[model samples]
Target: MRGYKQPTVSVIGASGYSGAELTKILARHPSVKLDKLYAFSQAGKKTTDLYPWLAVDMTYEAYDGEFDSDICFLTLPHGEALKLVPDLRNAGKMVIDLSGDFRLKNAEEHLRFYGREKPDDACMTYAMPELFHEEIRNATAVSNPGCYATSIILGLAPLILKPQDSAKVNTVCCSGISGISGAGKTAKTELSFSEMNDNIRAYKVARHQHTPEILQTLGTSATEPSFGFTFTPMIAPLTRGIYTILNIALDKHLPVSEITELYRSFYISAPFVRVREMPPEILHVAHTNFCDIHVAESGKDGSVVVITAIDNLVKGAAGQAVQNMNIMLGYDEALGLT
Candidate 1:
């Protein structure tokens, strides 16, 4: 960041889980100054009121159609960013959106998965730093990948990006279990302690919104992948972290060592992804920006399973958004995150 001025930043929807996490990170960032925090519901309250541990002395204000910073992070719900992103970009403010609003390239797919109609020009650079680093560096607006999509896409990217002809993918079936915080700050009966404490259940089976995001990213890397893909998202009892298990059927058997080496090589330059020799647990990655991945043979011929763990609010949302901001500003990709 030599010879570069500290960029001013603002966070909209700072009361939500992801937004608070982003605020915490930006408060201590060395190269940027957090200029404002906006939360419609939490407006008029100090950040310390909600997060007593945060050292920043700033009040949450309502966004008044004015962005006075060089960059803005939108942690609003789906369809909400659609209303703000266009104007922000037109005003020359770099934007990073942590919702499903601008991730899908195809408007029909966005409508089918997110249940909202997308405008013709609503798409942004899909911000998976490891996969699309250069594109994000030049993008004025970036769409952060969903929590589930982060784990599943990073787990499957190495194989999909450089597929071996002998090991053509036949099917991809994944199941993700995330902590309660991923549900946001809203209160729900099903997400209560009594309901989720000693229980876990799948909600969106095959029609999960992240399914299309996973398929879309993988398809972009390789020839339109024709393999069958299914995703089941579940909510577990905890505060943070997302664990994904992927069972992939290939045309030929691939040794675990070979797969491990491939993943290691793929994420060789990726600062936040760790290729593990043993399976990763959710607790190990809790509260961190690292995504731990382990690949193994499933004891059946031509079958391999990849396990990935990440903090849904960190690597999946806020931390990854900061990583994109670093790249877009020509700073080190892992500048403030490490």
Candidate 2:
């Protein structure tokens, strides 16, 4: 991240959903020199053998050896960061952590939800570029936001930038089909075809860990994260994407024209978020790094509803992680990520 050279990047957990996605993007980047891919569980195996689409390239080695890339993407699970970042950062490699570990600020707060172990004292900066691009621009350690939290928080983040004359949002988001793949490329009873095909049940209820993350990112403790959500998640048969719908209550009556102005003003410089009048569809952003958002309101009660859609594995995970990497390296920010 310190030099002007094309970055040498590496992906850990190379066989997982986000890991493979990161490998694909980096392998083609004109400025990113993809060094290696690592999957401890599938160590000593060819990545093409696992994710057949890769087809084994000579220019890059997949899971063949340990690496010393300029930038490292940790696509591991929550607690896994506690084990990897210290070693990588000590070796002077910039790190973009895609798990939940570094996103929360305090060690005790992090350990409370992610079990008893804590990550090393990391000076981690939030990596949702639209909100923290200034901070990410010079950070050595970055923490990407969760899928639900990214869509939910960013969908309504525009309202927070200004004094909401009285915008009170009551959000009820039904996360789309692809989140199960996010669960892991593993075998689970709930993820089985038999149980998931036509069945949908809400797991994690009121205690979903992402709940606090959404609140913390979007509102102040004094302002109150009174967002009550009916967050029902289903295992859809689709392979990728997350769509969130937030039903909001505005503090005062505001016109749609005014809302559009506010949204555009808030995200004019953000290249990935598209704020629209019509509802955002999953297909519009299925394979890209875009978060398409839409807003609607009821005049009678001053209520507004926001819809946000993103490819969970891309904008919600690897793509956004790379976006953070670009910022941290002082690159064009959108380099290699259109």
In order of appearance, the predictions have TM-scores of 0.96, 0.90
lDDT of 2 by residue, 1-338 (tens): 46747778888777788888888888877788887777777777777777879744522234433457788888887777767787788888888998887776555555555565564565378788999888988788888988877887777788765666556555444343345676778788878888787665666665556665666676532124465555544557667888777766665667777877888889999999898879888899987999998876657666767788899998999889888888888777788888
| Model 1 spans > 4 angstroms off | 1-4, 220-225, 298-300
The count of backbone overlaps in candidate 1 is 0
Worst 10 residues of 1 by lDDT: 219-228
RMSD of each: 2.0, 2.9
Model 1 RMSD in Å is: 2.0
TM-score, cand. 1: 0.96
lDDT of 1 at 168: 72
Residue 121 shift from truth in candidate 1, angstroms: 2.3
Cα lDDT, all candidates: 0.89, 0.75
Badly placed stretches (over 4 Å) of model 2 are 55-67, 107-109, 119-123, 165-178, 221-230
